[model samples]
Target: MSCLFSPIKLREETLANRIVMSPMCQYMAKEDGFATGWHLVHLASRAVGGVGLVLVEATAVEPRGRISDGDLGLWSDNHIKPLERIVKAVHDLGGKIGIQLAHAGRKSESRAGIPVAPSPIPFDEGYRTPHELSEGEIQEIQERFAEAAQRALRAGFDVIEVHAAHGYLISEFLSPAANKRTDRYGGSTENRARFLRETINAVRSVWPKERPLFVRISASDYTLDCMTLEETLRLLGCLKSEAVDVWDISSGGIVPTGLQPVAIGAYPGYQIPYASRIKRELGLITMAVGLISSPELAEYTLQAGNADLIALGRELLRNPYWPLSAASALGEEIPWPKPYERAK
Candidate 1:
């Protein structure tokens, strides 16, 4: 059997293969961040096409954390129905589904309503400077994450990923550059990591012990004052103690526009070394992401012991069948949908 097609047991959920469909925002949610028919069809088709794991996009733990007004949300019980449908559809097709629970931090852009964050930083020119969340409000937001996680449980999701990267709320708190307060939730690395740790603990408490808990973090700040590889290692080391099953390594996003680096400069698997380092250093399973599209590259990454799981973002977006096609291209027999057997 091809190693890529081998089963991976995360917590109690066993994935059929290592190819994970990274979450990409569709910005097509309804007014309440509820999944529309667009999400249902878009996510389900990938499972039908033969992805081992299809993770839904950055779902907000609160309305204010949405990257846009139309982003998917799990902030309320009402949000569960739409999500349950998506999860059921994916699983019914013999694939596992996970949800990326996120809070877009200072990156929150005004769309359906007012924007808010850990600081009043604006995502870009003309974007509203978000309302810096107060400490009490921060605690409340953690409660919201717990609530959303419970709703995810009700929605029948197999795994829950706390989205801490990509200039989001948790990311904001983690970045010393973004989090500029003298309070308990800011300043030192432990303090900066406090919010994310609390949020993770909150979600994990409600999330079934048998189910896996994943956290996506920027492996490097790619800028000064932002979290670095050393800090990330410390954070990942701490997170492992809290029972985080996988660390999805994707870099950048803490700094403001001028400091951010474009993806072009990084080589294929540019961030794999971070995943490898964390895995070796922290002794935890890690998922390598960022610009990994080809089957050979993905296999090479895994074979090199850089990551235990390979997450494909834009590649999967351009071709939802990338995994199945990759399996075929690599001489591995990936099962096709019964109806699409001849096509496969």
Candidate 2:
């Protein structure tokens, strides 16, 4: 079997292959954050198309944490059944599903209320200045993350990824450019990572040990003043005891637009080096993402030991059945859905 199509075990979850449908927000959820038919169809189609693991989009843990009003949420029990239906659909199609639990923080345009962050900094011009979270409020948000994990467990998701990247609440606290607090949650790298560390512990409190827990983090803020690769390494190293199973490495989104990395899509697998470095140094499983659409590139990345899994975002959105086609392209005879066997 080609490396891209080979099975890999993550904790007790054995993915059928290494092709992951990276979480991309659909921004199609209801105003109350309930999953609708669009979400069900969007995720299930990828399962039918033969993705190894289909991750649901960045779902908010609280109303104010949403990137917009349309983002999926798990802040309430009412959100559970809708997500459970999607999970059932994906499982029925023979694919494992995961959810990205996130908080957009100062980046939130949810209109729910004034967004909150570690500092009162706004994401960019024209964005509202976010409310700085106090110590008690920070702890409360951590509890909300724990509560959300419980909801995810009840929803029957096979994996739960903490979305700590992309200039969100956790990401805000992690980056000095965004975090200007004077408290323990905002000084040295250890202090900056404190929120994420505690958040992981909170989630792990309810999350099963056997099931893998993933954390998606931007390996770099792409600017010197913000989170650098070395900082990322140190930050992740400190979380080793949290028992995080996978580091889904993607870069940027910590800084605002103009100051972000210019080399993001300079080439395919551009972000693989970040994942490779993290995996190599930390001895952790890393998921390489960013423009890894081609079957050959995906296989080469694995063969070269750049990353353990290949995650695709826009590529998967453009072609839900990319994996099946990729399997054929690589000469691996993975099964197709019975209804689509003739095409195979």
Best by TM-score: 2
lDDT of 2 by residue, 205-249 (tens): 999998999999998887865688888888887777646988999
Question: lDDT (0-100) at residue 187 of candidate 2?
Answer: 85
Q: After superposition, how far is residue 178 of candidate 2 from its true place, in Å?
A: 0.6
What is candidate 2's CA lDDT for residue 51? Answer: 96
Off by over 4 Å in 1: 261-264
lDDT by residue for model 1 over 207-323, one digit each (tens)? Answer: 999999889999888764467788888776655664688889888877665656543257787888989999888888899998898899888888878899999888877898887
| Candidate 2 global TM-score | 0.98
Clashes of each: 3, 0
Model 1's alpha-carbon lDDT is: 0.84
Worst 10 residues of 1 by lDDT: 256-265
Report lDDT (Cα) of residue 24, candidate 2: 92
